[model samples]
Target: MASSWDNRVAFVVRYLYDIDCNGYLDAHDFHCLALRSCVLEGKGECSKARLQKYQHIMLSLWEEIAQLADFDKDGIVTVDEFKQAVMNCCVGRRYEDFPQAMRAFIESNFRLIDLNNDGILALEEYRYDCVQRIVVEDIKIIDEAYYSLLNDDDRRRGGITLTRYQELFAQFLGDQSDDCPAKHLFGPLEL
Candidate 1:
């Protein structure tokens, strides 16, 4: 039985990874996410080689997730399976204890979001990368959420670097506290 916190985390994961909104995560969802990334990068901006790399990374991520979460050995992962995997692998674990697949997924996602490849996520980059993908009722809400991910120092620095994002990602997954700002990493939580 998953706690409400687990459910909330699962909701965030499904919101991001379930690209088709079909309630199950499959290879096609990852493929669509890769296509979205290419589109975000724009046609000629991504180049054929870069597009191939994105596709490969997304597919590999899907493979890793499926291996961990697809308990039925089916091609798709249900929200329940995702929640269970989260409970087993993330909750109560330190960031350093996370599985390689989880770390790879995080790094790959960060790379995909860093459109300029500058190793930092500026506000505009975060806005374009996140807002375009999430279906939010109010755009302002997303802006607020983005700001919440940054501390005063991070704001002063002008952007979040990959290291900051990694720490936040770990918090979002492993922290049991409701006050964690990383809970807003994707967007507002229903809880």
Candidate 2:
């Protein structure tokens, strides 16, 4: 009953979000909010104040991203719903297209990476805080994918402004193919 494009979307979605290596994209990918608790406990390199900010930002990202597959609004994306969302995207019903959904996801991610809240993200922030934070074995691929979203001149500029970040994010979410470097975040792709 599924078309080739739908299958491709499913494959890409699985390849990009199955953080547990268990072929599923559920709330577990958010790591049970341990990162939040760690920050609250001052258990990381960032100061309590900075981590506090990250806590809110990360939570928002988790909620928005998870909602993409939470068809029933139950706060969890069952494997079935996850597959359905991918199929839906193939038909031009992308969850990322929703303004509120995309805004919340992007804003939270930018805020989390922009620890200084200076409205700009330094290269270190993009490389370490943003890319490194991804729970994947081959971070190099994620790094490549992220940088690929920017122009060479932009990369050379040494930092990304909020506007540039939005552009990069749009490119990232718009591409759903296996070669879309951002797909490396969940791990390597088989197709």
Candidate 3:
């Protein structure tokens, strides 16, 4: 059986690496990164300062994710490499205590998912990006219950901050739910 910590770590890693939203880590996500780099490179008519800022951010993120996922040192990460890298990362750390590089990857992906840049993940955003992909009915039920556990104001506001996300995952440590909602975020576990 997957331990509670295992489930949480897997959830966070899934949130970071599953960029194409097809429910698996693969080269397509890398292609998406490359395409973004191209956009930054070709932002000719856009403001130079804005383009430069985005370019630098994209380069940094590309470097970090490529370094982690590209295990064969072949300049690309295969599906196996992606899974191995995620499994190896933050092994000694708890759910919310991801290393700086891992945290950066999470934040980078979170920025992509947050769409409006409002510093929060609205309900629909979270539902579409993370929840809807999960197939198990019981797990979805758990997700709904956990989401309801958020503060009334945050629930009403339509989303939670990144800190609030981490907090909720941590809260799962004490929760006696048969299956964790956080785990469902990544889809069904093998256990």
Candidate 4:
């Protein structure tokens, strides 16, 4: 059985990957996400190359998920499959290469979120580009989550860089302590 923290992590993964909210993850969902990432969400038009890059990254992520989670050998992954796979492959630390696989996904997502190409995710960018796209949580919660990832200096400077995001990402996945601020990385985990 999975722990509450593992369940929460699985919920977040399902929430993010199930683009259509269809209750299952499939190639079409990943394809839609890739397209959405390339669309002009107030970030201006994405180049053909960039679109292709996003497609490649999302599809690669899909492949990894399928390999790890698609236990039925079917093309789609159900909620149960997702939960079990997340426990085994992620929080369980069963796969040694999982971190490297996740790094690619994280880096790609950071680039997608870092509009303006400034290498830093500004507050507005995080609110508009990242959080708004994922969930309709309150502004205060969103702001708090974003600010929690930053140190005093980084907060004063404006936003989190990719390095900082990577660290927070690690903490969010690996840390099980109640005091971990990264637990709010995708808003409050309903654990």
Each candidate structure's TM-score, on Cα atoms with residue i matched to residue i, is: 0.80, 0.51, 0.52, 0.79
Please report how far candidate 1 places residue 30 from its true position, in Å. Answer: 1.9
The window of 10 residues in a row where model 1 has the poorest summed lDDT is 1-10
Instruction: Give a tens-digit lDDT track for model 1, residues 52-117.
Output: 866987788788889889999989988888878777888878667777756766787787678888
Colliding residue pairs in candidate 4: none
Q: Model 4: residues >4 Å from true position, as ranges?
A: 1-7, 40-46, 92-101, 130-138, 189-191
lDDT of 3 by residue, 79-148 (tens): 5565465456544335566445445544554565576778887655665554534445554654564465
Q: All candidates' lDDT scores?
A: 0.76, 0.52, 0.53, 0.71
TM-score of 2: 0.51
Candidate 4 lDDT over 64-158, as tens digits, reads: 88988899998999988876776676652422336455567787778877778898888787777545545555787677767776788677767
lDDT at position 74, candidate 3: 71
**Residues 81-146 of candidate 2: C-alpha lDDT, one tens digit per residue:** 765654454233333464464455455656657767787776556666534334546657656645
| Residue 88 of model 3, lDDT score | 63
Model number with the top TM-score: 1
Q: Kindly report the root-mean-square deviation of model 3 from the true structure over all alpha carbons.
A: 6.5
Ten-residue region with minimum lDDT total, candidate 4: 92-101
Ranking by TM-score: 1, 4, 3, 2
**Runs in model 3 with CA error above 4 Å?**
1-31, 34-51, 92-101, 115-117, 128-158, 166-181, 186-191
